[model samples]
Target: MSDTNVNPQITDAVTQANVKVVGDAPAIAMGNLYQAAAKSTGILFQNATGTQQQGALAEASTNQGVMQIYAMDTAADAATQVKVAETGVADNLTGLLTVLESFKDKGNP
Candidate 1:
């Protein structure tokens, strides 16, 4: 207790203000912690969404590549059919046997 001449009312008001600040400290800290947690949760969801989208895009691209390969195979078969039709001879083991038979008949005649 100092022997100063400060008013009792003023001292009481200052003491109440300090107590109020101290009382609010825990609530302020908890609010900040909740805010940080919410932000971290939001970031985690955003990253998950991004990875899912990338995986979907990769799947789509792979499917397109497979479709292109199938299309190329069909196109090659069509070209071979056209060539076989124009030449009137198949290019297989049966075709080779037919040609050999024809040569054998010609040689015998």
Candidate 2:
């Protein structure tokens, strides 16, 4: 038999301290959530940050903009695909309406 008196307040304080330690770095929680979601959905992502370069290449690269390149490239590619799809949709709808009108005229006669 033990005669140790346990303090509820002390135990609660210890538990809170452990939680605080675990919560100190938000990256730990974020990374765990990301991993869990990826496992459930079978998707993976990586952050792509690189070290700063020094020289003419870095200066030349800095003079231009990556955002502009990505935006223009994506817009150009998507616009061509959308334009072709829209033309096909328009032709299909016109043909269907013509067929429906002929059916209506035949039924009314």
Candidate 3:
């Protein structure tokens, strides 16, 4: 055979492939890091959303409780007013009966 060797060409091809892979390593690592950061940000957003929902629910519950208390107070006030009116009516009826009795006594005399 001729003295031309193919080993040098093979070595050069292998070396070039290795260099390309080594050069791309940083890019691959950066892409992976970016994906991880995005995932972390999504998790944080979800947590914040959950907290806000909880706060809204708590506020609604407190408002409902306050409304209930107000309704009870209103009902109690109405009941007190009715009781006072009934007492006044009863007093008036008693006075009228007493006056009628006095008129009857005078007529009998």
Candidate 4:
């Protein structure tokens, strides 16, 4: 206990272990960097796929709404034609045209 001398073999072993760690540091660091980069790339791909799917859903919804609007317009036109046929006369615009003609005649005079 009084002699504070460390054995030469123990000192050499410790020194070799420290040197091994130092020599491997760059390889270990590079491996860690590559792993992190790969994980980030995977996450980016996942996000892109999710966005694409959402866009597809929105497009489909918009197309469905447009079709519904077209159908409604067609139904309205058909109903108007039926009414005109049943009445045997298309008088809906006649009154408006008469008023417009009067206004035109007044303006000309």
Q: Which one is best on lDDT?
A: 3
lDDT by residue (tens digit), candidate 1, 46-73: 9999999999999999999999887787
Against the hidden reference, what TM-scores do the models get?
0.63, 0.23, 0.59, 0.64
- Check candidate 2 and list the clashing pairs: none
lDDT of each: 0.92, 0.77, 0.93, 0.91
CA lDDT for candidate 3? 0.93
Give lDDT tens digits, candidate 4, residues 1-109.
4979899999999999999999999999999999999999999999999999999999999999999887787877899999879765457578778888998898764
Best by TM-score: 4
Worst 10 contiguous positions by lDDT, candidate 1: 85-94
Q: How far off is residue 13 in model 3, in Å? A: 1.5
Candidate 4: give the clashing pairs. Answer: none
Q: Write the per-residue lDDT of candidate 3 for residues 29-78, one digit (tens) a residue.
A: 99999999999999999999999999999999999999988778787789
Least well predicted 10-residue stretch by lDDT in candidate 3: 68-77
Go through the candidates in order and give the C-alpha RMSD of each one to the true structure: 12.4, 17.3, 14.9, 10.6
